[model samples]
Target: MADVETLHAIADAAASLQVLIQDAIEWKRQHLTDDLLSALIAAEDEGDALTADEMGEQVALLYLAGHETTVNLVGNAVLALLRHPDQLELLRRDPGLDAVAMEEFLRFDSPVQMSRRITLDELTLGDKTIEPGAFVVLGLASSNRDPRHFGPSADRLDLGRVDAGDHLSFGGGHHYCLGAALAKLEGQTAVGRLARRFERIELAGEPVYNGRINLRGLASLPLAVG
Candidate 1:
């Protein structure tokens, strides 16, 4: 009974969030005429264009996926730096390392911990054979830390890691995140600027987790910056 009530509450909160996002999408549709939504609406592929609902869905997806991922990326990066003052100092000394550092951050603590994919055909992975139509959840976080792909120091955060960008934080191929470039730019700018401006940064209290399993992030990160 309690579990059912909790699930209902969660569903209610999600619905409310969707409403808020849709409202914002509508507002953007009306007021803004020069953004991604507008572009998507105006986009044509061999005379085929997206309908109103399709455009709305695209915008909502961007808001849902891009917004939280970027927020969590920045938050997680800052938290990592705070925990590793030496690395933070290195970044403060050389802001150019932001791009590499961002890659390492994504690899060390990916915002999207896992991704889902439906098997189109029977496939064998190790000893397990997944039948067609089976839902497969790939552990992106685990893959990022895989020693075979990332070498001996896979678990460590090395900002200057030459192969850091090889991580699957943004996925790959056609299904790669559409807003990957934007997210990287925002993360680099935000974390780099923060490092450059703040002489000191420290956690003020215990951080609060979002409690989401797939999307790992903090709900609140109390900090003192100077």
Candidate 2:
């Protein structure tokens, strides 16, 4: 159950995003090119696949899924490395470790924590039996930290962990995130350059979270850099 304040916060945030989505669509209309927005626009103009209203809907989902979520991915990566200096130093010492470290960061604290799924058929797993049409909330973070696949040190951050890249952060199967590769590459570049560029990056104050339910991320990450 959500309190009035929480409901209001969500409503406010959604409204702001809708404004941004409209702005993006308008911008893309003025400057059509061979890009994502143009591609979506073509779907409506050429193929007649998406209605004008649904064009807005698809833009909202893509922007939220692609751009908004990546913000958290980088933020989460930096925070994780800060909490584990040894891990941060590993990247600082070896730029090659950036890619590997990003994987561990995703596993350590997945940017998006939960995914919603409807059971297609009856299924039994462990001790619980879920009936068909059951709505299940998959915990990406929980599965990433499972000891069964990640070993006893699953709870700890290990940049060199053999299976660290095999996380559920981008989901799996046909529903797998199309932007997973780009997201990982961006995370590697951002966190890597940040560590190498700064002589010192230390926490200046407590971090504040954005309070989004599905896309877990920091609203502000205070730091002192030299």
Candidate 3:
């Protein structure tokens, strides 16, 4: 997931992350003879067939997706709260709103904006017929803001929004994000602590966006905090 093409960030940071991915495969290869994972699989008779590429992909998926999702979610959530003081106050006054606020944060400004899938069968969605085998892109962020499910305040930020949990930010079904739980927990912790800890948080300067469509996030949140 640290593919340079997908993650357009500081080159140095990107290089360092890429190195981590490469090291994971090398580390596995170096300790293959004594690796606990291999030993466990062998004990279960599953065979030692996981290839280096597969291992790298898994590492990449776990490292990048999990980390980036929470990073973006926390940053975006904080920025959103800063912009909406009413919601920020609610979060600060009530610790119970931490989990619920995370959902709205994910919905209001999704960290991962889009998800792709191949149609299994010809289907009509909003009068557009998509054939089987067709490449389809689902706009998770757009769906999250749809007035249909979220009512007229869909476009607005509502910490206690009833249907915020129905958001597609974490995707859906079997292909849903594996790091969804981790991301939520991290987001809740980060956002909750910030609201409770800081007396004031406001945008100090212009916010910097990563300018990415898929994994969109704030590159930097220039803030005035107290």
| Top candidate by TM-score | 2
57-121: candidate 1 lDDT, tens digit per residue: 66668878989999999999999898888889999999889999999999999999999999899
Those runs of model 1 whose alpha carbons end farther than 4 Å from true positions after fitting are 1-34, 44-49
Cα-based TM-score, every candidate: 0.86, 0.88, 0.83
What is the lDDT for 103 in model 1? 93
Task: Estimate the lDDT of model 1.
Answer: 0.87
Compose the digit string of candidate 2's lDDT tens values, residues 1-226.
8999999999999878888888888889889999888988877788787986788788778877899788999998888889999988888999988888888989988888988899999999999999999999999989999999898999998888878998999988888998898999998999899999998999999999999887889999999999
lDDT of each: 0.87, 0.89, 0.83
Estimate, for each residue in 87-176, the C-alpha lDDT of model 3 and write its tens digit: 999999999999988989999999999999998999997878899999889899999988888889998999988878999998999988
For candidate 2, the lDDT comes to 0.89
Worst 10 residues of 2 by lDDT: 44-53
Q: Compared to the true structure, candidate 2 yields what TM-score?
A: 0.88
Alpha-carbon RMSD, each predicted model = 2.9, 2.4, 4.7
Q: For model 1, state the Cα shift of residue 60 in Å.
A: 1.1
Error of 3 at 152 (Å): 0.5
